[model samples]
Target: MLGRLDHVALAVPDLDAACERYRSALGARLSPPKDLPDHGVRVVFVELENTRVELLEPLGTGSPIARFLEANPAGGMHHICYEVADLAAARDRLVGEGARILGDGEPKIGAAGKPVLFVNPKDFAGTLIELEEA
Candidate 1:
């Protein structure tokens, strides 16, 4: 149902600063910022040899990332994404196991323009899990 880790998403208060830190300090390759209005986040992907790191900043006051920052101030790890061959099948399997899916329980277009679904954090031991279609 799950494949390799897709990317680790970090909610950041300042998107540009975060990108600079990864680009200059860590010497990481980063994708240009992309505004995901549907997700209410401005995102940039730090490309790596094995995996990618997604940096998310609030797009609006109502953004979920804004709420997250309100709680953590400095921002922090928001979720971990994993790849799945069949998103609907994986979703069903998770539902059968009583895992709660966030939003409408349907897959939405993700940063990679792939179908993605988010599972409730509580179900995954306080870590939000994102399932992206491979």
Candidate 2:
């Protein structure tokens, strides 16, 4: 089951410019940019009182964010993450409810270094959903 909102992700063409804009215009403090090679993204988190905003840029070949950006040249919201108390249980329950899990249906280490799984967008009204173990 869903625990709480974790972070909303945005695919950005330029990570530095996105971070700078968030910092300067929105007055948001950001975490240091991190390269997640396995996930194929470079990310920076905009700290907030209630939740975090994740800015993602494509890292290497076959990056999903890169494909997303290609279709949306201006870049846009990518996905939203929710915390789950038990990732495996959540995955099973979601599967039982006919929701399709992305990837190989296994959890991956997320930006927060927690086990995470993505539910297919087709199963969630076109919004890619990430479930991170709380």
Candidate 3:
């Protein structure tokens, strides 16, 4: 099952601009941008007292984030991540209960270098949910 709230992600057309705005205007602390080719995203984190905000920009033209930006244009909330102690166990339980897991139902290395998997939006009230191994 879900453990701690990991982070909330937002897809953006420009990572630099978003980071600048979050830093200068919002006075938020941000992490260095990390290119996650496997995930097809250039990512950064806005550090918060309780939780983090993940900013994602497409790493390639074919990236899912690129498609998200094409649809949203101005960018928007992408997904919220929750931590799990045992990713495979959680995945199996969710599957047994009929929840749809995205991407072949396997865990992929995520931003934090931990195993992660995404749940389909339809199964979570239209909100994409990411589960990260804690």
Candidate 4:
């Protein structure tokens, strides 16, 4: 089953600018940027007391974040991640309940180095959901 909220991901057109805005305006602490070639994103995590906020910028033209940015232009909340006790079991239960799992219906390694799966946005209202192994 799902555990605590992991991190809220925001797709940004400019990663540096976003990081600066969070740091300067909100006085948020941020981690160094990490390039995830496989995920097609460059990300920086804004440290928060309760949960982290992830700023994502497209790594390449074919990046999913790029597509999201193309649609929104100004960027927006991309997804919200939740930790799950057992990813496989959670996935099975969700599948049985008629929830559509994105990608190949298999868990992929996420930025946290934990197994993660994305549920279809339509299944959980209009917001995309990511479930990561706790």
> Residue pairs in steric clash, candidate 3?
none
Listed in order, each prediction's TM-score against the native is 0.93, 0.95, 0.95, 0.97
Candidate 1, poorest ten consecutive residues by summed lDDT: 60-69
State the lDDT at 7 in candidate 3.
Answer: 99
Error of 4 at 92 (Å): 0.8
Error of 3 at 68 (Å): 0.6
The runs of at least 3 residues in candidate 3 whose Cα sits more than 4 Å from the true structure, single-residue gaps closed, are none
| Ranking of all predicted structures according to lDDT, beginning with the best and ending with the worst | 2, 4, 3, 1
Q: Taking the tens digit of each residue's C-alpha lDDT, what string does model 3 give over 86-134? A: 9999999999999999988989888788999999999989999999999
Instruction: Encode model 1's per-residue lDDT on 1-134: one tens digit a residue.
Output: 67989999999999998988888898899999999888799999988899999999999658999999999999999999999999999999999999999999999998679999999999999999999999
Best of the candidates, TM-score: 4
**Residue 57 in candidate 1, Cα distance off native in Å:** 0.6
Q: Name the runs in model 4 displaced over 4 angstroms.
A: none
State each model's CA lDDT, in order: 0.92, 0.94, 0.93, 0.94
Weakest 10 consecutive residues of candidate 3 by summed lDDT = 103-112
Q: What is the lDDT of residue 68 in candidate 3?
A: 93
- In Å, residue 37's CA in model 4 sits off its true spot by 0.7
Residue-level lDDT for 28 in candidate 3: 94
Task: Tell me the tens digit of each residue's lDDT in model 2 across 1-134.
Answer: 68999999999999999998988898999999999998899999998999988999999999999999999989999999999999999999999999999989999888778999999999999999999999
